[model samples]
Target: MNIAIMGAGLSGLACAITLEKAGIRPAIFEKRSQVGDRFVNGEALLSIFTHPDRDNIATFSDQYGIYLSPTSHIQRMELFSKNKKAVIEGHLGFSNIRGREQDSFEAQLERQTKSTIKFHSEETYEQLLSDYTHVVLAAGDGAYSKSMKNFREDFTVSIKGVTISGKFDRYTVMSWLDYDLAPFGYGFLIPYSEKEANLSIAIPDIPKNAHVHISDLWDVFYQKVRSQLVQNLPITDQFQITQYPIGICNSPRIGNTYFVGNCYGSMMPFMGFGQYAAILSGVYAAYDLCGMGNYEELMKPLRQSYENSLVLRKAMEQLSNEGLDRIIHSLQGDWADKLFQSHRINPLKIASYLLRPYIKLKNE
Candidate 1:
């Protein structure tokens, strides 16, 4: 059976290897002349990995010269509204290195893959429809998957985001909390270097042309930086400013063509923990196409493991919002602080307010 995998990013390459392990040699086709350019992997955020094997894999920086930090330890985060005026802490999260580091991984994986990787300079969506029996579209961003109109009707997935990264101690490790400083989205202050940090803002599924003004978000950040945090990086230091749009794909996971990876729907909504999810999806796609009866049996534990991951994701989203609300409420004074502290710590209390599910489960 001839299998053609599309996009050599994390997802496509992973699928190729899985297929090779199954005694099938798949061909990888990348629209770019090179495999790793469109995809980036330096200081890429991996705030969202719960997989058991997550710690086992080496980063691209391990193979290539790019700077990639391994999973050292999970750090607790602190949220402060305008410097030390109000501070909140005791939250845990993680981030993986992305950007150029990711490109290096793809390059290395291409060499490690059992199948042939075809970097077609003139490759377009039209040719992909013509040449393969089974084509797994792992193409990310607007270029590839947007061409498939049917995909839109199936899922409600969109993201509006902003990110900026600069010299902050040459990619130092630190705790960054959502300043809760933005109106439309979340604000991020990434400590990249000792003398510089990137301030980021992200909104999920906001209109492309919304007239929402965010001068206030920066105003808060400006004042905060002028205070104690200023010692780390002043507000006037050179900074990287960017807009990042993020969303989850509401589409069904399996289909006729097997839309996988970012193409299937962002493996992660702006959290940027896409690499591993892409690799995992590729593993699932290979099992589907391989058609070995035992593959499904083999996949049971894998799916179960990832399903828990999905559960954790949903839970975290709920927790984040609740935590944000509690922080906002607590900033007023000690009475509110004591009341909001528990909510800040465990934001998923909404599970009790989940209407029928909780009631039914409770009754059960």
Candidate 2:
């Protein structure tokens, strides 16, 4: 079967690697000159986000044959609200570099694939669909899926971020839930190393946040970070994204074409964590192509996670500063420990079910 995979990001590369193992070498296409060809930043693979799987990297290697090395194992996470702060420590997850770096996740995945990636090619989906028997749409976003009338767009987000040179705890990640800084969104600091980190804020595109200036919010967030870290972190590079779609495809497979990665809605709407799901989607798509499994059936859990996260996102958007403060305060001590370390209970699913009624009431 002739196959063509779009975008050499996590999902595409993972698909290629898995297909190669099945004795099929798919044609890979990447718009960028090379893998990881974008702004360098830090992203976390939180264990809590991927319930039932405590360690993401280990599971990828053991189950999917995808070996990845994280920059640091996240041992601590600091959560800050408008009026309160909470710290959760333990085996939280992992932190990895994204984009352009030799050690980035994309670079690691690219090294595993034997298929040649046609870099700097502007090949359109319509053109590829006609030639290849099967096409995997892992274009790193939902644009093509939306164009194909398969995307279910829930919301859009504006994000601004920068790489800063400062003293940092590589194993500790920080996040803020102050509306004054990010409106219905949030801010985060993920460290790439002991001396470098990515500081960013994301604001959702809603009517209440329509008047929210990203630059203004960024300024406030920057000052807050400075005060919290007690350091004048010097920015070395910056990136800004507007109207970035965060949603899922209506179907994992439509006809002979398959959607994976962000195109498949691996990105959760709650806090934007989906690296593991994205990679898995690509592998699952490859499996379906090889007649090993059904893509739709394999994606059920990921889709459910997306729906659960959306419920949390809606509830968060309706919360006031005081409410956020209370939530943060509640997460302190034993509550935070149990929430992050629990394996028997899927916190996200439980929380979503509990919050559904409140969300319904608020909407009415």
Candidate 3:
């Protein structure tokens, strides 16, 4: 009874670790020689796992024994429009340590398990399926399974960032909303420490050539900096730009192979946060392989959240600057807290959200 997992990324490593813990030895194959090698040149960032629920990163790490260190803790988030700004307080931290050193998150996970990965094994899904009893497609972003039926181009984003040295609030992360700047996207600053942070913006290329290039996103960011949207976030001359396509996968299981991470379309639609989903998908795949539970059922909340976020994003795109301001203002109270804590959204919340503008209009 041999099992094989493709890709040595967080998703693949996570699946391997889970299976290994269950006393199941799964062969791990990666095209790259080492973990995090593919993302070395770019400025990569992922949210710190601090959800205020059973689904938080810490709880998952403890349960699975995967150690993740937080570079910065964002307990406060400020939202902005051209004429409106709102501050919401809660857990919104992130980890920038991925692929930083030779031995980082993925590397540490590999080392802790004392497992060996078959590097340079660029085997395709068809090849693997013929080889192992069960296969897990934990491939990272853009690697789709053959069973992925609806692999549509949801959005393409140009992400450019700089590591600036200045006095920054380590506890706070900020986002700006302007249809002109991001179109259907947004800009943000995630500070890893008080002295430095990764400042970047995601501009969606929705209408094909609509949003255009990374320099345009930078121009918008410069304007925001001059306007002091996030107080004093000084930008050094040092920076790099990278772009990637992100989308979702409809089915968790495709044939005899189970999909995880970006390969399965686990990436969230709104903010491009997929690390949590990626890790959880790996865990769920392992459990399903062991007959503990169905991967689709275990991942229902995450899938639902992805769908809910898509609805919210579409609604946001329809809002005017003033409407965006009103929405940001509404997000400051208890609703904001609840919104970030839960991974999934229910029908009642969706209904209330749809009627929110009318309620506000009636109140006015």
CA lDDT scores, all candidates in order: 0.47, 0.92, 0.67
The estimated TM-scores of all candidates read 0.60, 0.98, 0.82
> What does the lDDT read for residue 343 in candidate 1?
30
Off by over 4 Å in 3: 40-55, 92-96, 102-104, 146-153, 208-211, 226-243, 332-364
**lDDT tens digits, residue span 1-364, model 1:** 5667778877787778778777888877877777666423233333323232323244333422223233233332334432332433222233343333433556656766867667764566567657767777777642344555434321122222223333443333332334254432454544433444445444333343254445445555545544534443334323232333223333423344766666754444323446655665667778778774342353444334333333433333343545655655465455433433343332222322343241322113
* lDDT against true structure, model 3: 0.67
Model 3: per-residue Cα lDDT at residue 115: 58
Mind giving the per-residue lDDT tens digits that candidate 3 earns over 1-364?
6788898887888888888888888988888777776433112233322232323446666777776665555577778877777776665445444553554567666775545789889798778899988888877865465345645446556666665666677777778886666666777766656776667677655564363776866876766664684455566634444456566666778667887888876677667777777877898899898887899899887776665555555566566777877767777677766566555644334643675554322113
Clashes of each: 24, 1, 3
Best by TM-score: 2
lDDT of 2 by residue, 205-262 (tens): 9899878878888887998899888999999999999999998898999999999999
